[model samples]
Target: MIQHSLDALARFSAPDDDQLKALHNSIISLSTEGCGPRECRALLNVFERFPDHDGDGLFSSIVHLLEPCTGYETMLIKSVGPASVPFNALMSDRLLNSGVTEVGGQSLMALLAAAKAHH
Candidate 1:
Protein backbone atom coordinates (compact mmCIF):
# COMPACT_ATOMS: atom_id res chain seq x y z
CA MET A 1 0.00 0.00 0.00
CA ILE A 2 2.73 2.41 0.96
CA GLN A 3 4.84 1.33 -1.97
CA HIS A 4 1.97 2.00 -4.32
CA SER A 5 1.47 5.46 -2.85
CA LEU A 6 5.21 6.09 -2.96
CA ASP A 7 5.37 5.06 -6.58
CA ALA A 8 2.54 7.41 -7.32
CA LEU A 9 4.41 10.13 -5.49
CA ALA A 10 7.54 9.47 -7.54
CA ARG A 11 5.66 9.76 -10.80
CA PHE A 12 4.72 13.36 -10.12
CA SER A 13 7.23 16.08 -10.76
CA ALA A 14 5.09 18.31 -8.63
CA PRO A 15 2.42 16.44 -6.71
CA ASP A 16 -0.90 18.10 -6.14
CA ASP A 17 -2.55 18.37 -2.73
CA ASP A 18 -4.53 15.21 -3.34
CA GLN A 19 -1.41 13.28 -4.15
CA LEU A 20 0.30 14.51 -1.04
CA LYS A 21 -2.71 13.71 1.05
CA ALA A 22 -2.86 10.21 -0.40
CA LEU A 23 0.73 9.57 0.51
CA HIS A 24 0.11 11.00 3.94
CA ASN A 25 -2.86 8.73 4.49
CA SER A 26 -0.91 5.71 3.36
CA ILE A 27 1.90 6.45 5.77
CA ILE A 28 -0.53 7.00 8.62
CA SER A 29 -2.34 3.76 7.86
CA LEU A 30 0.86 1.77 7.62
CA SER A 31 2.26 3.26 10.80
CA THR A 32 -0.85 2.42 12.76
CA GLU A 33 -0.78 -1.12 11.48
CA GLY A 34 2.78 -1.66 12.75
CA CYS A 35 5.43 -0.03 10.62
CA GLY A 36 8.47 -2.24 10.13
CA PRO A 37 11.94 -1.16 9.13
CA ARG A 38 11.19 -1.30 5.42
CA GLU A 39 7.99 0.62 5.87
CA CYS A 40 9.75 3.12 8.12
CA ARG A 41 12.49 3.62 5.59
CA ALA A 42 10.00 4.14 2.80
CA LEU A 43 8.06 6.65 4.91
CA LEU A 44 11.27 8.42 5.87
CA ASN A 45 12.30 8.55 2.25
CA VAL A 46 9.04 10.24 1.51
CA PHE A 47 9.75 12.78 4.23
CA GLU A 48 13.30 13.28 2.96
CA ARG A 49 12.16 14.22 -0.54
CA PHE A 50 8.65 15.55 -0.23
CA PRO A 51 8.02 19.15 0.72
CA ASP A 52 5.39 19.84 3.35
CA HIS A 53 3.03 21.99 1.30
CA ASP A 54 0.42 22.26 4.02
CA GLY A 55 2.64 24.32 6.23
CA ASP A 56 4.55 21.94 8.58
CA GLY A 57 1.46 20.17 9.77
CA LEU A 58 1.78 17.15 7.52
CA PHE A 59 5.42 16.55 8.35
CA SER A 60 4.80 17.10 12.02
CA SER A 61 1.94 14.65 12.04
CA ILE A 62 4.06 11.98 10.39
CA VAL A 63 6.97 12.61 12.76
CA HIS A 64 4.75 12.30 15.79
CA LEU A 65 3.33 9.09 14.40
CA LEU A 66 6.71 7.54 13.73
CA GLU A 67 8.64 8.69 16.77
CA PRO A 68 7.71 5.85 19.09
CA CYS A 69 8.45 3.03 16.66
CA THR A 70 12.03 2.52 17.85
CA GLY A 71 15.19 1.81 15.81
CA TYR A 72 14.56 4.90 13.68
CA GLU A 73 15.43 7.74 16.01
CA THR A 74 18.59 8.62 14.14
CA MET A 75 16.83 8.70 10.82
CA LEU A 76 13.98 10.67 12.26
CA ILE A 77 16.35 13.15 13.87
CA LYS A 78 18.19 13.62 10.61
CA SER A 79 14.94 14.17 8.77
CA VAL A 80 13.98 17.27 10.75
CA GLY A 81 14.99 20.75 9.61
CA PRO A 82 14.57 24.31 10.86
CA ALA A 83 11.76 25.01 8.47
CA SER A 84 9.43 22.87 10.56
CA VAL A 85 8.85 24.92 13.67
CA PRO A 86 6.62 22.23 15.16
CA PHE A 87 9.31 19.61 14.76
CA ASN A 88 11.93 21.86 16.29
CA ALA A 89 9.75 22.39 19.33
CA LEU A 90 9.06 18.68 19.62
CA MET A 91 12.75 17.85 19.34
CA SER A 92 13.64 20.50 21.86
CA ASP A 93 11.15 19.09 24.32
CA ARG A 94 12.45 15.60 23.73
CA LEU A 95 16.03 16.70 24.25
CA LEU A 96 15.25 18.49 27.48
CA ASN A 97 13.48 15.48 28.93
CA SER A 98 15.42 12.65 27.37
CA GLY A 99 18.54 11.41 29.06
CA VAL A 100 21.93 11.62 27.41
CA THR A 101 21.92 8.77 24.92
CA GLU A 102 22.84 8.24 21.32
CA VAL A 103 19.40 9.21 20.11
CA GLY A 104 19.24 12.29 22.33
CA GLY A 105 22.71 13.33 21.25
CA GLN A 106 21.79 12.94 17.59
CA SER A 107 18.60 14.91 18.08
CA LEU A 108 20.51 17.72 19.80
CA MET A 109 23.13 17.84 17.09
CA ALA A 110 20.52 17.78 14.34
CA LEU A 111 18.67 20.60 16.05
CA LEU A 112 21.87 22.60 16.34
CA ALA A 113 22.75 22.02 12.72
CA ALA A 114 19.26 23.02 11.65
CA ALA A 115 19.46 26.18 13.74
CA LYS A 116 22.80 27.04 12.21
CA ALA A 117 21.51 26.42 8.74
CA HIS A 118 18.44 28.53 9.39
CA HIS A 119 20.52 31.48 10.51
Candidate 2:
Protein backbone atom coordinates (compact mmCIF):
# COMPACT_ATOMS: atom_id res chain seq x y z
CA MET A 1 0.00 0.00 0.00
CA ILE A 2 2.75 2.42 0.94
CA GLN A 3 4.71 1.46 -2.17
CA HIS A 4 1.67 2.32 -4.22
CA SER A 5 1.45 5.67 -2.52
CA LEU A 6 5.13 6.34 -3.14
CA ASP A 7 4.77 5.46 -6.81
CA ALA A 8 1.86 7.83 -7.08
CA LEU A 9 3.80 10.56 -5.33
CA ALA A 10 6.72 10.08 -7.66
CA ARG A 11 4.42 10.32 -10.63
CA PHE A 12 2.85 13.42 -9.20
CA SER A 13 6.26 14.97 -8.87
CA ALA A 14 7.31 14.04 -12.37
CA PRO A 15 7.60 16.66 -15.09
CA ASP A 16 4.61 15.41 -16.99
CA ASP A 17 1.42 17.25 -16.03
CA ASP A 18 -0.80 14.43 -17.22
CA GLN A 19 1.09 11.96 -15.04
CA LEU A 20 0.67 14.35 -12.14
CA LYS A 21 -3.06 14.39 -12.62
CA ALA A 22 -3.21 10.63 -12.82
CA LEU A 23 -1.14 10.29 -9.70
CA HIS A 24 -3.29 12.82 -7.91
CA ASN A 25 -6.37 10.85 -8.86
CA SER A 26 -4.79 7.64 -7.64
CA ILE A 27 -3.98 9.28 -4.31
CA ILE A 28 -7.56 10.39 -4.02
CA SER A 29 -8.63 6.81 -4.46
CA LEU A 30 -6.26 5.61 -1.75
CA SER A 31 -7.37 8.33 0.65
CA THR A 32 -10.99 7.42 0.18
CA GLU A 33 -10.41 3.93 1.57
CA GLY A 34 -8.90 5.55 4.67
CA CYS A 35 -5.14 5.99 4.98
CA GLY A 36 -2.86 5.27 7.90
CA PRO A 37 0.46 6.42 9.33
CA ARG A 38 2.34 4.66 6.57
CA GLU A 39 0.40 6.55 3.94
CA CYS A 40 0.95 9.79 5.84
CA ARG A 41 4.68 9.15 5.98
CA ALA A 42 4.78 8.47 2.26
CA LEU A 43 2.88 11.67 1.53
CA LEU A 44 5.16 13.56 3.89
CA ASN A 45 8.13 12.25 1.97
CA VAL A 46 6.66 13.65 -1.21
CA PHE A 47 5.83 16.94 0.45
CA GLU A 48 9.45 17.30 1.53
CA ARG A 49 10.69 17.45 -2.03
CA PHE A 50 10.65 21.24 -2.22
CA PRO A 51 11.35 24.14 0.10
CA ASP A 52 7.99 25.59 -0.78
CA HIS A 53 6.18 22.26 -0.71
CA ASP A 54 4.73 22.98 2.67
CA GLY A 55 3.56 26.33 1.43
CA ASP A 56 0.97 27.02 -1.29
CA GLY A 57 -1.69 25.28 0.80
CA LEU A 58 -0.28 21.81 0.08
CA PHE A 59 0.76 20.98 3.60
CA SER A 60 -2.61 21.87 5.01
CA SER A 61 -4.29 19.71 2.41
CA ILE A 62 -2.02 16.79 3.26
CA VAL A 63 -2.63 17.22 6.94
CA HIS A 64 -6.34 17.42 6.36
CA LEU A 65 -6.24 14.22 4.40
CA LEU A 66 -4.15 12.50 7.06
CA GLU A 67 -5.77 13.84 10.21
CA PRO A 68 -9.12 12.15 9.77
CA CYS A 69 -7.85 8.95 8.22
CA THR A 70 -5.07 8.39 10.70
CA GLY A 71 -6.85 9.53 13.84
CA TYR A 72 -3.56 11.25 14.42
CA GLU A 73 -4.30 13.03 17.68
CA THR A 74 -5.59 9.93 19.35
CA MET A 75 -2.73 7.87 17.98
CA LEU A 76 -0.24 10.38 19.31
CA ILE A 77 -1.73 10.19 22.75
CA LYS A 78 -1.98 6.46 22.66
CA SER A 79 1.43 5.79 21.20
CA VAL A 80 3.45 7.69 23.74
CA GLY A 81 1.13 9.97 25.65
CA PRO A 82 2.73 13.14 27.09
CA ALA A 83 5.52 11.67 29.11
CA SER A 84 7.54 9.50 26.78
CA VAL A 85 10.78 11.35 26.66
CA PRO A 86 12.47 8.73 24.55
CA PHE A 87 9.67 8.75 22.06
CA ASN A 88 9.82 12.52 21.78
CA ALA A 89 13.57 12.46 21.35
CA LEU A 90 13.30 9.87 18.62
CA MET A 91 10.56 11.77 16.92
CA SER A 92 12.50 15.00 17.10
CA ASP A 93 15.53 13.33 15.63
CA ARG A 94 13.55 11.87 12.78
CA LEU A 95 11.73 15.11 12.11
CA LEU A 96 14.82 17.30 12.28
CA ASN A 97 16.89 15.10 10.05
CA SER A 98 14.10 14.22 7.71
CA GLY A 99 15.22 14.80 4.08
CA VAL A 100 13.37 18.08 3.82
CA THR A 101 16.22 19.92 5.56
CA GLU A 102 18.63 19.19 2.72
CA VAL A 103 16.84 21.89 0.74
CA GLY A 104 16.02 24.33 3.57
CA GLY A 105 15.60 24.18 7.30
CA GLN A 106 12.96 26.80 7.82
CA SER A 107 10.38 25.04 5.74
CA LEU A 108 10.94 21.83 7.68
CA MET A 109 10.60 23.72 10.93
CA ALA A 110 7.41 25.28 9.70
CA LEU A 111 6.16 21.87 8.74
CA LEU A 112 6.98 20.52 12.18
CA ALA A 113 5.16 23.44 13.77
CA ALA A 114 2.21 22.87 11.53
CA ALA A 115 2.16 19.19 12.40
CA LYS A 116 2.30 19.95 16.09
CA ALA A 117 -0.46 22.48 15.72
CA HIS A 118 -2.53 19.89 13.94
CA HIS A 119 -1.95 17.50 16.80
Candidate 3:
Protein backbone atom coordinates (compact mmCIF):
# COMPACT_ATOMS: atom_id res chain seq x y z
CA MET A 1 0.00 0.00 0.00
CA ILE A 2 2.85 2.36 0.87
CA GLN A 3 4.66 1.49 -2.30
CA HIS A 4 1.45 1.97 -4.25
CA SER A 5 0.95 5.40 -2.77
CA LEU A 6 4.51 6.38 -3.61
CA ASP A 7 4.23 4.94 -7.06
CA ALA A 8 0.96 6.71 -7.60
CA LEU A 9 2.68 9.93 -6.68
CA ALA A 10 5.61 9.27 -8.96
CA ARG A 11 3.75 8.08 -12.01
CA PHE A 12 0.94 10.60 -11.80
CA SER A 13 -1.60 7.82 -11.60
CA ALA A 14 -4.27 8.41 -9.09
CA PRO A 15 -4.55 5.62 -6.60
CA ASP A 16 -7.87 3.86 -6.31
CA ASP A 17 -10.23 4.82 -3.53
CA ASP A 18 -9.20 1.77 -1.56
CA GLN A 19 -5.58 2.84 -1.74
CA LEU A 20 -6.48 6.33 -0.63
CA LYS A 21 -8.42 4.98 2.29
CA ALA A 22 -5.52 2.71 3.22
CA LEU A 23 -3.17 5.64 2.92
CA HIS A 24 -5.39 7.64 5.21
CA ASN A 25 -5.42 4.87 7.79
CA SER A 26 -1.69 4.33 7.44
CA ILE A 27 -1.05 8.02 7.93
CA ILE A 28 -3.33 8.08 10.92
CA SER A 29 -1.37 5.22 12.47
CA LEU A 30 1.92 6.87 11.61
CA SER A 31 0.79 10.05 13.31
CA THR A 32 -0.79 8.50 16.36
CA GLU A 33 1.05 5.29 17.14
CA GLY A 34 4.54 5.87 15.77
CA CYS A 35 6.76 3.64 13.71
CA GLY A 36 10.44 2.95 13.07
CA PRO A 37 12.48 5.86 11.71
CA ARG A 38 13.12 3.94 8.52
CA GLU A 39 9.41 3.45 8.00
CA CYS A 40 8.63 7.00 8.96
CA ARG A 41 11.31 8.33 6.65
CA ALA A 42 10.01 6.33 3.73
CA LEU A 43 6.42 7.31 4.33
CA LEU A 44 7.35 10.93 4.84
CA ASN A 45 9.31 11.07 1.62
CA VAL A 46 6.47 9.43 -0.23
CA PHE A 47 3.99 11.87 1.24
CA GLU A 48 6.19 14.85 0.43
CA ARG A 49 5.75 14.07 -3.23
CA PHE A 50 1.96 13.98 -3.09
CA PRO A 51 0.84 17.60 -2.85
CA ASP A 52 0.78 17.79 -6.63
CA HIS A 53 -0.69 14.39 -7.31
CA ASP A 54 -4.23 14.59 -8.61
CA GLY A 55 -7.15 12.31 -9.48
CA ASP A 56 -6.89 10.34 -6.24
CA GLY A 57 -8.65 13.00 -4.26
CA LEU A 58 -5.75 12.78 -1.82
CA PHE A 59 -6.16 16.24 -0.40
CA SER A 60 -9.87 15.83 0.01
CA SER A 61 -9.39 12.54 1.81
CA ILE A 62 -6.91 14.21 4.07
CA VAL A 63 -9.31 17.00 4.84
CA HIS A 64 -12.09 14.56 5.48
CA LEU A 65 -9.96 12.37 7.69
CA LEU A 66 -8.65 15.25 9.67
CA GLU A 67 -12.04 16.85 10.00
CA PRO A 68 -13.33 13.93 12.04
CA CYS A 69 -10.12 12.55 13.43
CA THR A 70 -10.78 9.45 15.52
CA GLY A 71 -7.92 9.86 17.97
CA TYR A 72 -4.54 11.56 17.97
CA GLU A 73 -5.29 12.74 14.45
CA THR A 74 -7.81 15.08 15.97
CA MET A 75 -5.31 16.59 18.38
CA LEU A 76 -2.82 17.09 15.61
CA ILE A 77 -5.39 18.52 13.22
CA LYS A 78 -6.67 20.94 15.81
CA SER A 79 -3.20 22.36 16.35
CA VAL A 80 -3.32 24.26 13.10
CA GLY A 81 -6.86 23.54 11.95
CA PRO A 82 -7.40 20.90 9.27
CA ALA A 83 -7.14 23.48 6.50
CA SER A 84 -4.14 25.42 7.71
CA VAL A 85 -1.63 23.52 5.59
CA PRO A 86 -1.57 20.94 2.88
CA PHE A 87 -2.01 17.51 4.46
CA ASN A 88 1.08 15.95 2.93
CA ALA A 89 3.32 18.73 4.15
CA LEU A 90 1.71 18.74 7.54
CA MET A 91 2.08 14.96 7.99
CA SER A 92 5.69 15.01 6.87
CA ASP A 93 6.47 17.78 9.30
CA ARG A 94 4.67 15.99 12.08
CA LEU A 95 6.63 12.84 11.40
CA LEU A 96 9.90 14.69 11.53
CA ASN A 97 9.19 16.96 14.47
CA SER A 98 6.61 15.32 16.64
CA GLY A 99 8.97 12.94 18.48
CA VAL A 100 6.78 10.15 17.31
CA THR A 101 8.88 7.61 19.12
CA GLU A 102 7.22 8.84 22.23
CA VAL A 103 3.74 8.85 20.81
CA GLY A 104 1.83 6.22 22.71
CA GLY A 105 3.25 7.44 26.00
CA GLN A 106 2.78 11.16 25.55
CA SER A 107 0.04 13.59 24.84
CA LEU A 108 -0.37 14.40 21.16
CA MET A 109 -1.03 18.00 22.12
CA ALA A 110 2.66 18.54 22.86
CA LEU A 111 3.79 16.70 19.76
CA LEU A 112 1.41 18.73 17.65
CA ALA A 113 2.72 21.89 19.24
CA ALA A 114 6.18 20.84 18.15
CA ALA A 115 4.88 20.27 14.65
CA LYS A 116 3.07 23.62 14.69
CA ALA A 117 6.32 25.34 15.60
CA HIS A 118 7.91 24.00 12.45
CA HIS A 119 4.86 24.48 10.22
lDDT against the true structure, per candidate, is 0.57, 0.48, 0.46
Best by lDDT: 1
Per-residue lDDT for 69-107 in model 2, tens only?
544433332232223323322343344565434112234
lDDT of 1: 0.57
Query: What stretches of model 3 exceed 4 Å from their correct place?
Result: 1-13, 48-51, 54-119
TM-score of 3: 0.32
Which 10 consecutive positions of candidate 1 have the poorest summed lDDT?
47-56
Rank the models by lDDT, top first.
1, 2, 3
Clashing pairs in 2: none
Q: Pick by TM-score: which candidate is best?
A: 1
lDDT of 3 at 21: 65
Report the Cα lDDT for residue 14, model 2: 45
Model 3, residue 114: C-alpha shift (Å):
25
All candidates' TM-scores?
0.59, 0.46, 0.32
